[model samples]
Target: MLIWLFLAMNFIITEVVKGIKHLYNEEVAESLISIQDTRKEFEGQATIVVFPIVRFSKKSPEQTANDLGAYLVDNLKEVTAFNVVKGFLNLSIANDYWLDLFNNSLLQPDFGVIPSNGRKVMVEYSSPNTNKPLHLGHVRNNLLGYSVSELLKADGAEVYKVNLVNDRGIHICKSMLAWQKWGNGETPESSGLKGDHLVGKYYVIFDKEYKKEIEALKAEGQTEDEAKKNAPLIKAAQAMLLAWEAGDEAVIDLWKTMNGWVYEGFAISYKNLGVDFDKFYYESNTYLLGKDTVEEGLAKGVFFKKEDGSVWIDLTADGLDQKLVLRADGTSVYITQDLGTAQMKYDDFKMNESIYVVGNEQDYHFKVLFLILDKLGKSWAKGLYHLSYGMVDLPSGKMKSREGTVVDADDLIAEMVATAKQKTEALGKVDHFSEEERETLYYNIGMGALKYFLLKVEPKKRLLFDPAESIDFQGNTGPFIQYTHARIKSLLLKADYTPGVFIDNQVALSETELDMIILLAKYPSEISAAAKTFSPASLANYIYEVAKMFNKFYHEIPPIVKEEDEQLKRLRLSLSDVTAGILKSGMRILGIEVPERM
Candidate 1:
């Protein structure tokens, strides 16, 4: 498909060259070279009229073509005919003019990177809480984080991926208390549940049982409001927290058991997603570490001690509400722990920037954090960015743990893999491959589809998880892209062609083929843009476009039919090979896989 596009683009350039020659007549050769001088004349006219394609402001396909056309026309000749119409620009390039530009693009070293090199970037995401297994929200967070980090790496920046584990908090304690109250000596093995799901089940059981106990109190002549506030289950949970805070052995032991299970579950999910962390910070280990920093700030007058012995930062001057850094009891709050984590990370890496890939609900928290950091005279505070993405809402409603509608991460992945296996079997192609090979391929395609669907949208936009619609195998989905790649692989094998060997034969390209080639060539540019904006969806959309274009080209052009020289066929095959390489690499950034067959 890529080869066909390259040939088509080559043909378009050939046609454009012929047009330029006809427009210039005998003076075409001199006019093309002389155009380099903006002052030069082209046949009696002071300017040569060139028509460029129309483009939109939002960086659509038409805009890209128009920009490229303008760039080519401008460089080839001085006083080139180029003007913007509404948004479209028509630019003309002489036949001889295109010959030089095409030669340069074909031979350029590290195409596009030199012109687009930017700064280093770091994206941190997948900060899972240890109280429950990961859910749909974590899936989007991880996908976007991983993809953005990869985009930066591809664009000549040092990229670092990190994860923060919310290993402590009252929520985690609830899971532990529930486990102790209900869980006997039963293990995940005995229960026949995935480790994470088993732990999550106990957590759900805790919520249900707690609510039931409250309702029971209301039924016994107690006022509904009082019963809700003074339920025995709620009291018991509070007592457990006090015990845990007081270093009670029993409470600590229970906390360890459930937390370990949740962590183990998280490990499985991360492994399946092919996600890794350059560094891992646990909230428990860092929660108390911020106390000293707050104390220092208090002394420096960066923060003030409230009358109740709590510490507070007046953020009203910064157009935000004042934030409490510590409770009157000297207990660290969420923001306090984050302060310590930020300091620790900077001390360790001294990175120019630190990005927190968190949800948008905490926008105020991050704003205050950076302001407080700035108050502390930390120069790097300016570089701290909170990449707040929107929440993932299901078609039914927002996921509610109490209502039991939260999609468990492990369950989701398992279901996707199962669906993939069933599809592969239905296609009857699994029989031709070994069991191990077929399973691997199925897993890749299934997981890729899941990740791509989530990451293909902008991070700041709320996502609707329509399971059936999202996992569609046809039309603008991950499976569609995988199928295109698989089809290319199948074609390559059939052609028995080798890449890197230049062919001497010339072939004409259809318009569809040229469009695909142009799209493929724009990959490096798209990757660079994605990295610059910290938006993985941009690249995700670009890959989808490439896949769509390649598919169209494939349907229209026959690679193996009526093609003459082995060299020409091989050249085309090389383009497809490169396209596949880019697809596989780009998908990897989003923690997706491309199956050789799907």
Candidate 2:
């Protein structure tokens, strides 16, 4: 895809080198002749940095630009005209060049994609705990992971999407104990609530009641810290955790039932969010996996046992404190399972890379994990990456799970769809549509708006998501891009667009039309940069520019269906088709759907 675009730059660079040699009697290297897209204010398609060639010319910057511009205009047919801005020499390509490119290159379906390189990658995300339903934070994590996987695939990699479920531990035990102490046995069927929501209700109830217990103890002349440790509810939850690990049939059965409920709820939310996993690893199953690994590390002297029989790795010399891999009572720490899981994933796929899409809070945790794996002489340690992102904040403020103020993923999605419906109907375009079409269109736009709003920013930056602001049709929002795509589709349908049509004769080009073509030419670059940086923000904003430019062209140029010149009309219609194709392609990488109709 980039080959065609680079050919133009290559031609300009080759000619600039020749121009320097001819004028200065100096043979300049092609690398020394730098070229880029000309500034919008300049009346050209490409620019050359004449400052670098100044040493050869032995002239002022302006004089250098003027000298090279004159040579290119006279010698190269592709170079129709030239303009000089200080040391920058901007060269205009002939109309025939853009016309040929639009006809032959831009209209291809996969114009911006990288061909498969057969490299394998795994992205793990949405590792939600089974104690509660997923919230807005999980929403961001899932979207970032899914789109990153898509971008990697677009960059010619074979990507695997996976999830790790934290279905066991003290947190899960809290919800179980809360439910057990409550009056009656309530199920999803009985409560008419989603399974995860039901479990989450108990989790919150546990916190509410646990707080009361702590307050009561503190009121009894106890320090606040001491009261927290002596809280009866917390002690019971701890006991439940031990009983769970002991494989007591009654406790184990209850744990399985609650976790099962949460999983079912997660599946529903994931489906609504348009995200999925290729495989799922549960902590309950993987928690003990690292003991063997710990044993191996001990044998290799990479790990040492403390006086109380705890397995630890001293990393103080490596600039980190000693990290525990196993407890004194033969229990695994969080890092222990992570080490085993890393090795297990490598063994399973032998993939070239692994990316864990976690939040920024775990930054140090991953740093330690990767260092330990590397210290263990693992071959794939260097390929591990932690795709850390900032937390999402609502207009209200930060979310808290125990207080039950977090934005539920399922609820937020439904609210977005509702907002989309209200905003979309005000346009009054759905009157002629059926119920099902309206619903589908609403889902696409709502989900598109949500995903775009979250993914448009770099993952490292925390963002305040406003659903109302994201569904606008006149700004850099998802609906705006979707509406542009639908408009282009409408224009093409009206013009009765013909495929494989080329403009043979030279025709007048509007400034807006020229700008549209130039922006269209940048589609491949947008994809490549986004893939290289693993940033959908770059691609998302690039698509916005394409849509914005096409809108300008649409309003500024004469209507295509009404134009009398057959060749000109064909060119305009072809431009519209390619613009829509590129918009759809870019949006797909961001996991957004562009509708054919508004």
- Each prediction's whole-model lDDT (CA): 0.70, 0.87
Candidate 2 is scored at a TM of: 0.95
How many residue pairs clash in model 1? 16
Q: Clash number for model 2?
A: 0
TM-score of each: 0.82, 0.95
Residue 364 CA error for candidate 2 (Å)?
1.0
**Number of clashing pairs per prediction, in order:** 16, 0
What does candidate 2's lDDT look like per residue over 1-598, in tens digits?
A: 1222444458778888888889999997887777777777778878887887888899998998998899998888889898888888888898877776766667665677678988899999999999888899999999999999998898889999989999899999999999999928999989988999999999989999999999999999999999999999999999999899899999999999988888889889999988888999888889888888899899989999999999999999989999999999997889999999998989998999999999999999999999989988998999899999999987778887755668888898998898889888988999999999999999999998899899999999998876556555458889889999999998889888876666664876777777787788778767767877878888898889998888888888778899999878987888888889888978998889999998
Candidate 2 weakest lDDT stretch, 10 residues: 1-10
Instruction: State the displacement of the C-alpha of residue 80, model 1, in Å, after optimal TM-score superposition.
Output: 9.9
Prediction 2 global C-alpha lDDT: 0.87
